[model samples]
Target: MLTLYRPGTGWLHRMPAGPKLLLILSVVLVVSLLPAHWSTAAIAALVAIVGYTVSGLGPGLRGIRELGHQMFSLRWIMVITLVSQLIFMGPEPAVANTARVTAAIVLAALLSLTTRVTALLDAIERGLRPLERLGLDAARCALLLTVTISTIPVLGRRAAEVRDAQRARGARNNPQTFVIPFLIVALKHADELGDALTARGVR
Candidate 1:
């Protein structure tokens, strides 16, 4: 699996998972509240650069490169969106939205790069512990969160594989080739995961 996590010995990595998660949330809140300005976006990018440096930038950059490659492969969609924005709202709004989205993606990716899946889940469980008074089950919540995060890469890879296979078999660029197989595979994976969870008494 192409995980964004990078094993490191930096201060960010050594910090307790709880605080790291809180930091991510704080960044998100601040970014959301701030006006979408070039200066604010540049600061966010700088923070993401520091995060990348601390966590070892090789893996993170590689992940970003892979994302770029994927986007290039789907260039038509992006081109359509850009052209539509130019025709309707002009280039400035499109550029601002693009910067905002890019900053969010980079910041979140930095969080993943600095924190392991296990640490993330542990932090989540601890954060939810306070909600136990309201009949919330922390363990189950953590497990669900973990499963959901873990499955994203799996589903992504599976969809890519299915798409490639269909393309090789001369399937047209239609909804069925992409969507139907992905849905079927996702459902199958979900069913098997549920069965495994039941067998392990996770519920």
Candidate 2:
């Protein structure tokens, strides 16, 4: 989901976006591909501390909470993943997998919180420039990424609106009761987005 860059003069704010992005990718890869250990949790804690320090106390706490909420939204998937891993690979692998994933997510959130959206987009485009030799349009790829990130929060808000309406009508707050209406709202939102983009002459 897209989040605004909080104006700040912190070290992270002044850091070059390209290097920050590269560091984020490197950290996520290390945490994800390496065997997990208690050290992994330490890494996560360290990243979190840096994120908070860079963001400064007030905005930093808010940013971390926002990132935490996104991870919280995936609770069911984490639960299922842990349970399946526990059944097949035992507790150790389960814990490792979950911890690594959580750390990767936290690191990504830190990157987003610290970097400006335009800077992030420029960095992504620069990274993808090599693919232009393969006939890929780097600008288009960056635009798509921008739209995708921005649309996530829009769709999430639509879902929340649908849920609240259903609740007000006394519908049970279960997936069975919510999914259909939520889907309908999402489709409608997508249609509106498409029309707006078309009107703006975006391909």
Find the candidate with the highest lDDT and give its number: 2
| lDDT of predicted model 1 | 0.63
**Positional deviation of 144 in candidate 2, in angstroms?**
4.3
Q: Write the per-residue lDDT of candidate 2 for residues 15-132, one digit (tens) a residue.
A: 8988977876787787787665656656665665555545542443765665565455445446667788789988777777776766665566566656777788798899899999
Task: Please state the error at residue 61 of candidate 2 in Å.
Answer: 4.8
For candidate 1, the 10 contiguous residues with the lowest summed lDDT are: 69-78
List runs of model 2 lying over 4 Å from the truth. Answer: 1-4, 37-42, 55-74, 144-202
- lDDT against the true structure, each candidate: 0.63, 0.67
The per-candidate count of clashes, in order, stands at: 0, 0
Residue 114, candidate 2: alpha-carbon lDDT: 65
